[model samples]
Target: MATFYGGVPLVTEPIKTPRYDFVRAPIDQVNTQIKNDLLYSVSNLPVVGQTAAEQRVNKDVARQLLAKVYLRTNEPALAEAQCDAIINSGKYSLVNARYGVKAGSPGDYFSDMFFKGNQRRSQGNKEAIWVLENENPSIIVNGSSGSPQQRRVWGGGYHNINGMIPADSLGGRGLSRIRLNNWVLYKLYPQGDMRNSKYSIHRQHYFNNTASKYNSIKGLPVPYGQDKQYTLSDGTTVNIAKSDTLAKINPYTLKWGQFDPNDVFGFGMWKDFILMRLGETYLLKAEAQVKQGNTSGAAASINVLRTRAQAPQVSASQMTLDFVLDERARELLAEENRREELVRTKTLLQRVAAHNTDGPSQRQIVGLTANNLLLPIPLNEIQLNSQAVLEQNPGY
Candidate 1:
């Protein structure tokens, strides 16, 4: 119920008869259980502590989960009211300025939320709702990592770039494994938006290796200027107007650019990962308000995040589910699960069919249908039960 929907059976015991296991639970029943459990925790748990905030049930997070459950349960008014509670709590506010250790630096507010030693309530970041603290492995024993993999999972691996080597200045090392869709880069935000600016996204590559012939210009940065040309070590000119044609990748997101100086290859980033923040809460509230036909309220909720980014404000007349999803991508890219969000809003097929350039080109999303929405039940689950025949999802 908490993770998935559909007519999945809830097996409560270790080994139950096939007759009992074959009985699938209704979607509403599972949603009710999830809602009850969250509300119980919200009503019984104390507020998150400032110092030892571990394993604590945050009321705002509980409310947010309940609101999501209500949205799936067809209770728009209930969802809206749950979000309203968090909005008026006054305990949490969006971090809208440079703060913490790097307040004097040139970094933006959005990027600061992910920095190490700055993702907790005690760290002066009031926006963090829930955070994962990754500590030093020497003291915490595997709390960080066993090898060179602390940040590579989310660091947007960039080592594949032709001449762009890993360094502290270039957002540590990256393999560029996670490439954004064309729509996420080009259509999600307006020009001049801080979230997509050069500061937030590392779009330039500089020659930093001193061993090459271009070593004289080692620190010379190459921008994606109109005249896309670079002189190689052999004094040969290379035209890389098309970003993909060049070894150095362009317009990569820098939100997860955490660098560990101790890492031999600069591939291990051991910063704490942010699970939930107030910025997303506002978006969730806006989504609930939009579903309830409160267009003005929805715009106001969304405008708070946009204003912080110094982007254009949204109008009440322009509020829609699609617009809300787009704003989510702009603000929460690589932070939340994209496929779940799209599936929850019933826009997976439509959005993918329209904006998924690579999917169609690779023949992956071809002939996708509603049947593809729910995953087929595992064949092992059906075969293991001997008392009764367990049914499988259609188009398995």
Candidate 2:
């Protein structure tokens, strides 16, 4: 890292679009300012006293941010070049084996990164680029704000289960507010792919409590034998026809599980959240290659990720922007913002209308169009400005 501001006075303003001010700058100008700031961070930050791992992580983050901005600006060559540099830098690598405290455990590389203590560079996952750390619940005297809800949003609210207690094996008490759409489970990952395996997604659940009458299956597995018959805690044998009976059909994810022995039902899941990792950089490169009409190069970029997950190799003929987006969904589902990714590719409305099962019935599918692509400028801004009128987006 080097300093570049010898004596120059750089002009700066807030990157966010003005809501209450009249005569706001154009969107492209704001984007240019953001791009310049990110470029400065990548090229001019000092790394004198930082540890080796810290320097590596900082560079990784800076490059990734630049690549993201490049993607937004439709600079495919620049985006692909940035991604290639990160992949070839030797500072980061895909986490292929169990490391850190969970070494020799029964977890795969994909699930290892999401575990409570395995997210940082010092924690042994070289895949991590930028991690948001949460202090341990026991030692922190003052409670934390902005604590992550990775578990609550991604994990199933199986607490809705009748006559069952929340357990670590069941991914704690998930609100399941942001459960996966059917496409993620049925369409994205191929069979036997590690990202969708039982290690990553919890497809089975067993009754764990013993007090209730439905607890006979307590210690018994769900959909066991498919006979749909279970003996009650009081010794009454009942024939349950539906396989999705309570205490049996809780299918969820274990990736965001952070068990706080102290507060089991606490809202905030105190675990380090991975902001960027090497796996997604590969996807970004593949996307840029596809945009540049180099399908073979895109396939090569994507194969690195597919090979690590033991997924079937993709051919150049199968390379498309949609394929790249699907791979992103499979590999970086809960780790990244799906909306932001889709919006970046300009496929948000189309994909939501196509793969979202609930979109049509809920009228969201019908409501989506090119006009609604960009958010409308706030109405208050227009009303407040007496000197000039603030234009709103087309739809709203």
In lDDT terms, which candidate is top?
A: 2
lDDT of 1 by residue, 46-142 (tens): 6666324653557777888788778766687888888788878787888887888677877777777766778877788888777777676755666
For residues 174-267, write the lDDT of model 2, one tens digit per residue.
7765656567766778977999988788876665665767755676654532555666767676553353322234356787887665787867
In candidate 2, residue 291 scores what lDDT?
A: 89
Q: Residue 193 error for model 1, in Å?
A: 1.6
> TM per model?
0.86, 0.84
How close to the true structure is residue 263 of candidate 2, measured as C-alpha lDDT? 82
